[model samples]
Structure formats: C-alpha cells, structure tokens
Target: MPEVFTNELNLFSGQLYMKSMNEYLSVRRFLGLRSADQKDSEPELSGSSTNVMDTETPNLIKFLRVLTMKIRRNCESIDKTHLGRILDHRTLDDSDFANGMDMDM
Candidate 1:
C-alpha cells in the first residue's frame, strides 16, 4: 500500500497543488468562507450577494479614436481585412454603449 502523506506535505505536486489551492481559496473567499484561524472580512451574503450591472463595456468613443489612429499610423494603408475588423469592433462597441445607456432610465 502507498504511504499517505499529510496535506502540508505538498512536496510532490507543486504547481498543480498550488493552482488548485488558489482556485479553492478564491471560491471560498468569494463565498465568505475563511480559514478557522483567520477572521472573515467579507461582507455578509445579504449585502454582498446582490448582483450589479456591468457598466464597463469598451468605450465606443475611445474605440473609434483608436481605430482612426491605427489607420493613420499605417499611413492610411491598412489592408481591407484589418479595416473591416476595425469597423466591426466600432459597430459592436457603439451598439453595446447605446444598449447600456438605454438601461440607465
């Protein structure tokens, strides 16, 4: 039979164990589970659990400016595909911004 080692003996599995532990810590931290020896600093579920709106969508004005800068940076000589992609991103950003603003009222 294989001899079992203690949890503290994470000597064999380094990166994998650390990654898993980080994930566990994140979830437990988010859900207000702290170690027995540590204090719980997270707000209670009633106040912290409420979902909030995402108000940080890509800025359409900034997107347009960046797209224009990229085109100008290339001496107005960008390929059709790159230009198309920029246009598409601009359109999507504008639509997203408008939709988010509509929800403000």
Candidate 2:
C-alpha cells in the first residue's frame, strides 16, 4: 500500500513537473526566447560585439508586458473554473448523490 501511494505521488509530481515545463516553454516561445531543448545547441552571443540593451530594451519590455498579461488571463480562467466546480459540488442535490452523479466531486 505504501509503495502504491509512493508510485502515485511520483506520478502526480511528474505530471505537475511536465505541466510546469510546458508552461515555461510556452512563455519562452511567446517571448521569443529559445526553448529548453534548443538551449544546448544555441550559440552564445559576444557582449563586446553588440549592444543589445541599447537597441532591444523596448522590444524586451513589450514582450514581458504581453507575457504578464497572458499569465494573468490564464490565472483568472483557472480560478473561474475551480470556483465553478466548487459551487457545482456544493449545490448537488440528494437525488444527484443517490444517482452517483455527484461522484465527480
């Protein structure tokens, strides 16, 4: 039983980790950064050759703002979905429970 629980915990953790990684990749792609799998192969730029900060600061700021807004929207959507689920479970009738329709809770 303990081993089963440990396996389930590990599976859940792995799923969460994958979800987080996917989100990170999505944000990185949205911001025009290299994805994780491409990082190792991506070439490093020389700081002496170009002044990126001088030319790209505005673009970077815009990208960051867009990313922030997207994250906020996603959070709001998730909150609404969670709250709806909670309200639905709270409002389940006795007949719904007896019919096993409330098993989703």
Candidate 3:
C-alpha cells in the first residue's frame, strides 16, 4: 500500500481505509500490474481486514453491487473503478480512465 493512504489509516474510519485499499488495487489493475505482484505484499497496513470495513454509511464507497449484495468476503478480490469524491468538488472518473478516456486530473 502507498504511504499516502496508509499514513493516515490509524485515524481513518474503516470505510475510508477500505476505499483507499480498493482504490490502490484498482490502480494496480488499471495498470495491469496485479499479475506481477509477489505473494506477500502487505507492506504497511498490518493485521486482517476482516473488521476494517465497519461503517455506518456503508454506501459511501459504493462497492459494485452484484445481485443486490455487497460482498464482505474476499473484499480485496474486487477491483472496481471507483469515483472517489472530494469536498464540494468532483473527482476523476475511474471508469473513463479505464475505458481509455482522457481525464484532466
């Protein structure tokens, strides 16, 4: 995991942590580097993620719904293009980037 996300994880709620993780994974997938990762690559964030996603607003990160169910198992297994938000501002569209569309940062 990158320091930008991991550095503040202790202060982050489970939901934010999960979003950061998912976003990191999504970037790796976007770059086609998932297959190149080694077996043990949990760099900074320690412990299991089993209880990290405990959030009151479960829909904040909006995990891709499958059959009306958001997956809780193997959460790292899902690499989705998420539109991360900012305060009163828009974020780059991951879907557009994934589809080879230009983004203006």
lDDT of 3: 0.31
Put down candidate 1 lDDT per residue, 36-87, tens digits, no spaces: 4444464432222122211311343234335444543343422232223332
Q: Model 1 Cα displacement at 65 (Å)?
A: 49
**Which scores higher on lDDT, 1 or 3?**
3
Worst 10 residues of 1 by lDDT: 7-16
**lDDT string, candidate 2, 1-105, tens digits:** 443343234322321111233332332332233323445466422211122333463575454334433453443322122212221222212332243222111
Q: Where is model 2 poorest over a 10-residue stretch in terms of lDDT?
A: 78-87
The clash numbers for all candidates, in the given order, read: 0, 0, 0
* Pairs with steric clashes in candidate 3: none
TM-score of each: 0.21, 0.22, 0.18
Off by over 4 Å in 2: 1-19, 36-58, 61-105
Candidate 1 residue 3 Cα shift, in angstroms, is 36
lDDT of each candidate versus the true structure? 0.29, 0.31, 0.31
